[model samples]
Target chain A: EPEVTQTPSHQVTQMGQEVILRCVPISNHLYFYWYRQILGQKVEFLVSFYNNEISEKSEIFDDQFSVERPDGSNFTLKIRSTKLEDSAMYFCASSEAQLEAFFGQGTRLTVV
Target chain B: AQSVAQPEDQVNVAEGNPLTVKCTYSVSGNPYLFWYVQYPNRGLQFLLKYITGDNLVKGSYGFEAEFNKSQTSFHLKKPSALVSDSALYFCAVRDMQRGNKLVFGAGTILRVKS
Candidate 1:
């Protein structure tokens, strides 16, 4: 089965540095999303993208965070300045519509 | 605002026994509920979803959920559990009027012991 794929299974970045997480969603998917889960915490929604633009975002998705569909197949999330609290597992997901979404294995972001 | 509540933080069941993970939700409009499982060091895997039809929704891996509108609950159930079923389970909800973003519960750790 086709699945969302994320690169760099793990990443460690210095505080105040930038980091980019990449994801290739299923080819036919129309909606893409980014969510993060802090250790021992609930999965929190960050942002959703559709039609090459942000459809919606949560409070946690502040100015420091940005998402882009750099190409037809690549969706990337960039954090301009990483903070210690940014350490978490970042998941990329895509869906045909607003229905079931398939998730990627996740990129573990560690900011020291 | 939409929210999901997984009442139990953890549930323990023996292999071959039936298991149920409780989930209750609160939404403003018609709710779309989903159940996802996460194994250690893995992402959330879709298990089942309740959109419109039958209240009882069957999903992958022999898992099923019953959607109760009145009770505002969608509980995940599995008959004859296996050790492989042990993992972290999450219940999520999305209100049709609130857009497609899913609101997930804190998650429940299911331990199916052999």
Candidate 2:
């Protein structure tokens, strides 16, 4: 079955440095999303993208965070300046519609 | 706001026994509920979803859930458990009246012992 794919299974970055997480959603999917899970915490929604623009975002998705559909197949999340609290597992998901979404393996971001 | 609650933080069941993971939801308008399973070091895998129609929704891996409007609950059930079933399970809800973002519960860890 087709699945969303994320690159760099693990990443470690210095505090105040920038990091980019990449994802390639299923070819036919129309809606994309980003969610994060801190260790021993609930999965928190970050942002949702549709039509090449942000459709909605949560408080956790502040100015430091940005998402882009750089191409037809690539969706990327960029953190301008990483904070220690930014350390978590970031998941990429896509849905043909709003009903159900398929998720990628996730990128583990570690900021020291 | 829409939210989901997985009452039990963890549930333990023996192999070959039936298992149920409790999930209750709060939402305005109609509710779209879903269940996802996460194995160790893996992403959330879609198990099933309840949009409309039958209250009992069957999903992948011999799992099913019953949607109760009056109770406002959607509980995941499996007739017989297997050791492999041990994992973290999450219940989520989407508010149709609001937007497309999904609100997830804290998650329940299911431990099916052999």
Whose DockQ is greatest here?
Answer: 2
lDDT of each: 0.92, 0.93
TM-scores for all predictions: 0.97, 0.97
Give the alpha carbon lDDT tens digit for every residue of A48-87 in model 1. Answer: 8888888889999999999999769999999999999999
The weakest ten consecutive residues by lDDT in model 2 chain B span: B94-103
lDDT of 2 by residue, A16-111 (tens): 999999999999989899999988469999998889898889899999999999869999999999999999999999987657989999999999
Docking class of 2: medium
For model 2, state the Cα shift of residue A43 in Å. 0.7
Per-residue CA lDDT of candidate 2, range B1-114, in tens?
999999999999999999999999998888989999999889999999999999999999999999999999999999999999999999999755444878899999999998
Fnat per candidate, as a fraction, reads 0.62, 0.72
**Candidate 2 Cα misplacement greater than 4 A, ranges:** none
